[model samples]
Target chain A: MLRNTPIKRKLTVIILLISTAVLLITCAAFFAYDLFTFRQSMVAHLSTLAEMTASTSTAALAFDNPKDAQETLSALKAEQHIVAACLYDKDGKFFAAYPANSPTNNFPTAPEPAGLRFEGSYLVAFQPAMQSGGLQGTLYLKSDMGALYERIRLYSLIVLLVMLGSFIVAYLLSSLLQSQISQPLLQLAETAKAVSERQDYSVRAAKLGRDEFGLLTDAFNNMLEQIHNRDLALQEAQQKLRQHADDLEKRVAERTARLSETIAELEAFSYSISHDMRAPLRAMQGYSDYVMENYGEKIGPEGQQYLQRINRAGMRLDTLIQDILSYSRAARAQMDLHPVDLEKLLDDIIQQYPGFQPPQVEITIEKPLGSVIAHEASLTQVISNLLGNAIKFVQPGQTPRIKIRAEPRGDDLRLWFEDNGIGIASKDLNRIFAIFERVHAERTYEGTGIGLSIVRKAIERMGGQVGVESELGKGSKFWIQIKKS
Target chain B: MAVLGNILNPSKEASNRRFTHRLRACLAGFIFLLLAINAPAQISREYQLKAVFLYNFAQFTEWPPDAFADPQAPLVIGVLGRDPFGAYLDEAVRGEKINGRPLIVQRYSGIQDVQNTHILFISDSESKHLLPILASLQGRSILTVSDMEDFVPRGGMVRFLTTNNKIQLKINVNAVKAARLSISSKILRSAEIFPPAAK
Candidate 1:
């Protein structure tokens, strides 16, 4: 029943229970001893009374005087506990009785052997009256056990009182002393509760003594100290991480700005260099034509052939420079996209160049080619370069067959340029679109390497993708995809 | 004139007197025979009781050291006159001891004949000489007993009195004390004291 009570109450209850048990046992033992001894002393007392009455009555019995014996027996009246007494002659005849006029039936008809015994609630004694070392008569006495019962009642009261007093004292003492242990534990509990509730580890329990509770408090404080320190260290680490992230972001932004400025300056320098070199080349071409026409007879055939070689080299260099300029322009141009008819663009391109005439090359524009969203100028340059490469890379003396078509693909339009040409190897396919990378030898193909590079850059700037499908010694298929209008 | 005439006829008168005397003697003998049949049993019972009383006195009374010749001497109960108890007193004290002393019955012809006696029952035959007998045995520690009237008043220690067919005791405490013999209170509680208290 006491389990789970506060420590103080539990201690008090335990002490009270132990003391009550001990007191009850001790009182019970004492009560039993008192009852036993009281019975014994009662017997002794009755025997003594019987012996006195018997001794005094002996002379009366011997002298044959009933009155004297009666008087002797009457002395028992002074002892209130003795209820009745009588005397018998040596012949065992009833002689005299106490209270002189008491009924004969009150006395035994005959005397029993001399001894003391308890009969029900009475103590009875039969003592021999001796005279001259002869058995003169017997003396009989009966006493009530009222005194014994009275003593028992008194002892029970005393035992009960003692037990009550002892229990109260035990309770009081335990209540006072239990706090010595419970106080320290309660303080530690409060400290722990505070730590959890606030998520703060700076609080400590007060040490009340140099005991186990004190040691527990010390350990608790030490744990709190470690937790507090770790919390601070974690916060410091998180703050340092945030600062490093901010610095990295700032450095990346600064580097990106500087790189973009350097790229603009390099693009401007290349554009001006290409533009200035073109003026000089144009002047050189005019003067060479003038020399050929005016001094035709005086110069002769060898000088004229050398002038023609110089003129051809100058034209190739000019084409190479113009391809480089076109590549650079494709890389840096701003695109404005709108829908353009693929069939119309293909027809215009075929008519613009005599190289695309029917006797020279077969150009078939698939009718109803889908229109797409693209930068028109970049799309024209990409298609023109693809058609030029198709015609230039064909087998010797074979008619170039070019098939141009467009198809709708999801949200975009795909344009295909199929040509019968000397195809590229699989290993060199990936590097085909790089600037100045010519797969065929200059003497055999007679072309600059930047045309495919310009085509790829112009398509990427217009937000489209371009790829090729070709096998060696067979035709190649080049396709580009752009959003459909 | 009639008396002078009877004197002339004397023979006849003497014969008449002889007849009357014989008749009286026969009647007396018959009465005595009847008394003899009844009195002896009563007297024997009385003395039997007195003999037991004598034995009892020895138990209840304590004598000085000089009362015995030695620690082992027998307590002698002496009869100084006609021994009324006959063998009854002997029977009462047979195989009995008082404080480790054996008890014995003795008969004395005179006061001088009483030697080493703790108790002496002076019979009615010595009633005439009781005063002198008690006086002569004054300094001695003997318990002197008798059934005579005024025995305790005359310096006898104890007396047996018969009243209403029951025997009772009267003790002279003064005489008992003077003899240096102490009677137990048990005996005193049941006895009449001499020199009765004044009302």
Candidate 2:
């Protein structure tokens, strides 16, 4: 059975029909048995009565005092239960009879003693009688078997009547049982149909008994309860999800607003640095040019040198300002983390510096760098700064030997820039990474001291760590470790 | 023979109880019938089944040959007074024969008419006639049946009763033996056999 198909009606119908059938079969069997036995016993009794009457009617068959023989037989027949009697002669002829009655209008010939017996409205008996001359006659006597048959017939009729009555009763009972069970089952089916069609679960089945049907009803009710509970739970969960989505939308709106504000501030700050700062530098340059132009004849070489020094000082300040702006911008830059292939990046950066002739630098590059998750531009800046510093501080008369390698620490990428260069004094190593702090004077270095500081700031903004290793009169090695995320 | 012996020996108390029970059922049935006639024409199979059982029981029993002197004489079944079955029993058994004997039912007031009877059915209305009926029936071929207190011990052959408001029956073997009548064993298996009373 499918779980959905209700069987209460079918079950009740089967039980009632089976019970009725059993009852009918039992009654019919008994009726048939009774009919058989009644017929058998009636025949036996009639035969016995015929035999006894025949035995007593021997005198009538002999025709000795026929009147007395007839009277005796008549007396026997006169018994309240006896219907009629007759006597037959040995020649298969009628000799005397009782009650003056015959099943047929004419008396039937006496049957052969060895032949089959006959039965009808009369019950006849045969016996042999001795005559005075040693001769014998077959005596035949008959009595009505009507009453016996009538009794049996009446009994059979009564049984038939009873069977008919019981059948009607059984049929009615079966119908009643069918209705009682089918009504409830139909109701359940209708409710189930309605539930399926309308997708509603509110309807319930009525309990009819404590039988299997009743148990089924209870189960159905429980199922409905569970479905309703699950539905309620689902609704509650959906409501919670909706609430979470609304909260997320609110957070996204707030973040977008903050981002736009930050972008506006950056643009305004960049504009201020670009115009205001450059204007003063331009005026200083123009002033220095005027001084050189108007006082050229009176000025000695030292004076011209002083003017050149002033112009150079002004240009250095401009360059330093530009570097400061660049460093600040790199520090403030937002990161878009993605896969950065260091090998490809290092290769690209090194290619840009191909102008350095005799690229014979024994640069033992470790198995080219692998990809890491980081801000691609910021990570490239760190690498380029280190690589540029190594190229700049080369040992006199030594090939610019460099080794570039990478290592992963946890979720971070660590890169090493080792090179053969004019190593810094141990004491200056610490201060060299600070902004505007250089180991050699500006004249000898011919470079701003802001490179290492910018590198440190760039790495820090990208959530990374930077360090240096150096010994006076040896090459320096700089290392940077960046969080992969 | 065991069945007949058991049926011929029933206890006084059990017979009395059965008699009272039968009397009550007869009264209840009569009342129910009266109520039924006006109430509706619905068939009461329960009552009909009882009637059928009683009719069948008659078929299974045999009367002595002397019980009928003339073959035409009615096999009188006499009820002393107050017929309990009304006319339903009569109608059910009408024109019926048992053992080549035509059935006849009558109400008698005294023992003088009892000699012609084959069965003397003593209802509660004729309870007072018990002793006289017994005395007249002693050593005779008559089968005495009754629904009365201690009817079996008092020498009635059969007692009808009600249990759980359903019809039931009890038998007295001693009474049957005394009547010189042979009851069938099939009927005895179902009937509640009461032991003979202690003298």
| lDDT at residue A252 of model 1 (Cα atoms) | 92
Docking quality of model 2: it rates as: incorrect
Model 1 chain B poorest 10 in a row by lDDT = B1-10
Q: For all the models shown, what interface RMSD does each have?
A: 18.7, 21.0
Best model number under lDDT: 1
Interface RMSD of 2: 21.0
Residue-level error in angstroms, candidate 1, position A362: 34
Please identify model 1 stretches exceeding 4 Å from their true place: A26-51, A77-80, A96-124, A141-145, A234-485, B1-43, B107-116, B135-138
Model 1 per-residue lDDT tens digits across residues B1-199: 0000111111112235456445434544554477655434544666777898888888888989987888999999999999989999999989988778889999998889987788999987787787889989989999999877778878898988665456668899989999999998867766788878778
Models 1 onward score TM values of 0.57, 0.38
Q: Quality of candidate 1's docking, in CAPRI categories?
A: incorrect
Clashing pairs in 1: none
Residue A40, model 1: Cα distance from true site in angstroms: 5.2
Model 1, TM vs. native: 0.57
The candidate that wins on DockQ is: 1
